[model samples]
Target: MAPRSSRGKSIRQRGARPPQPRAVSAQDLGKLQGLAGLSLRKLEALRARMRIRQFSRHSTIYKEGDESDDAVYIVLSGIARLVCLNRKGKRNLLEVLGPGDVIEIPSLLPDIHHKLTCETFTDCQIGLISPTALVEGIVGIPFREFNEALNLTVGRWWTLLERHSNFLSQTVREKIMLALLDLGRKFGRRDEHAMIVDLGLSGQDLADLVESSRPKVSECLKSLVAEGVVKREHRRFIIDSVRIQTSLRS
Candidate 1:
């Protein structure tokens, strides 16, 4: 096996950790998808039972082969990337999760070790709920509403699967175009001639997300800029929706 690079400090550090219970709020609980319909009392109860924590940029949330424990996580803000390393030490990005997404739920049932590592791409707040609490809450909730929540969570996973498939099959140019479109649909704002993606991912990071080499990504981006399909700011890309869409079709 290849040796792991010593890049950053261990996630568990000395000194008193921040008080999680006091940090949680009803408003924060409301931001999570499955818990939206939950009452304030319920939220408070859950908060007391869970560990609500904050992590800075590039912090490792969990590592592969770590005990799964009985915990699941909900993103409160910012983004995180799930990644896996192959036997050859090649890194593969599994998915990028934003606020309201849950992590590590599937591993909770069998209580197996984590299969992938989760790392923060930006500063983020997260809530950790014990598997017992989660199961109890689900059992207490109405069957219809629980089913609806399950469906929504499954749909989110399906979207991630489609994105991963696209990254595997598409060329760098096609991937960039599709990424721009997806970002525009999710969080874009309109300009005079284009939709601006406000996500602050760096060029190299974007290349990793699309499973492409940085030089190839840069070449494609430059071509797009020259063709007026995308305009680059310092880090963000402002994409001409019509041109980007047309390029993808062709």
Candidate 2:
């Protein structure tokens, strides 16, 4: 038998990273409640299959032109942005997603890859559910349960195409108005009279969203403020709910 080493061993291994604490709980999956109408009872079987990740602000979760995301990700808390690179390599903002939003419905597809980059806008907790688990978690799962999920994937592309076609025909000012209206509906918080969008978007972000330049977007925003359409306060965009509703309908 070999003799034991005489030197005392260190309990903490040098150059080894510390273990990270789990950032999510089984109880935190309520963020997925709307997707496939998931509930605690529905998630019970998949509990062992799920995982969580904590992301810091401005961290890139995935990049454009990547071959695969391979699984579905749900934002349990905080915000994430979808960005695409233009032909000139400028980053264009596609959308900002908050809690409860799924990264892409196509995550259900085994061979699918992302068309855009996803990144955290703030410190975030993300829930991960693999496609394999989605396939086997429930009885006869893939046959019937995947219908609505697949429909969302088609609908998402339809909406994006529709927006692209509509954008080609819009004036710069018109484009800005529609873009603000879309964001207001998607990310806005409401008080008594106003809708506020505070997704850390700047003029450049809006420009990216609208596929315009910063100067053009800034001019349109200033014009909107002058016309009582949308206002900027404390670096957040604000619009009167009642007023914008009328304007949108007109």
Candidate 3:
């Protein structure tokens, strides 16, 4: 028979060990959406119960239909997207998330499956806390500020759906143009003459975001290129913010 390794022998003797909780800092707490303006003492208390996690780009943090309401995930850094797959298995992009964003506040509530999948758009740092710990952690924040933060968080989804409704009246060209402008503002960096969006997204990803077919999006991109509203160089999009805004106004 093969001899047990020293590590295995030690584990058997010592039994299982619990993972240590990661330390949280005031700066970290300040970045959280609804938890700003918290006192140092409160921040310290919450820090005790939090754990940090890292995920590579394109990783799924939570899947749709997951039954466990284990912990709340907060984005400490990098971008993430909420997506849903329909009955036909068609992908629909819901929202883009960044630092200080929570995956879902409602996940803290009991007896609910995750309705949308949360996937990282870039290499991400995330903070996690149990619902119980979270409840105990935020005991002293001002109710008004906390409530307003919740409203704004929920309001963003409503706004996204509202924009989708508004897009129904717009042409495919107009829709892609609007999508480009929005993404540019969120993810683009300003160069000498344009805002460059370098998300490394493919044509299909953009189509998912714009809620249009790839063929139509390709056609609109050609139109946009011809009109000089947008240009592409090495897979990055160069957007003329001034021109697009002016076109929108006109």
Q: lDDT scores for all predictions?
A: 0.66, 0.61, 0.64
- Per-candidate TM vs. native? 0.61, 0.62, 0.55
The regions of model 2 sitting more than 4 angstroms off are 1-22, 31-36, 45-47, 64-68, 85-91, 110-114, 138-140, 143-187, 198-218, 240-250
Q: Considering every candidate listed, which one attains the maximal TM-score? A: 2
Descending-lDDT candidate ranking: 1, 3, 2
Q: What C-alpha root-mean-square deviation, in Å, does candidate 3 show against the real structure?
A: 11.2
Global lDDT for candidate 1? 0.66
Q: How accurate is candidate 3 locally (lDDT)?
A: 0.64
Superposed on all Cα atoms, the candidates' RMSDs to the truth, in angstroms, are: 6.7, 12.5, 11.2
Worst 10 residues of 3 by lDDT: 6-15
Error of 1 at 108 (Å): 3.3
lDDT of model 2 at residue 68?
A: 40
Which of 1 and 3 is ahead in lDDT? 1
Could you tell me how far off, in angstroms, the CA of residue 108 lies in candidate 2 after the best superposition?
Answer: 2.6
- Candidate with best lDDT: 1
lDDT score of residue 143 within candidate 2:
34
Candidate 3 error regions (>4 Å): 1-24, 28-46, 87-89, 109-114, 139-186, 189-220, 227-229, 233-236, 240-250
Error of 3 at 115 (Å): 2.7
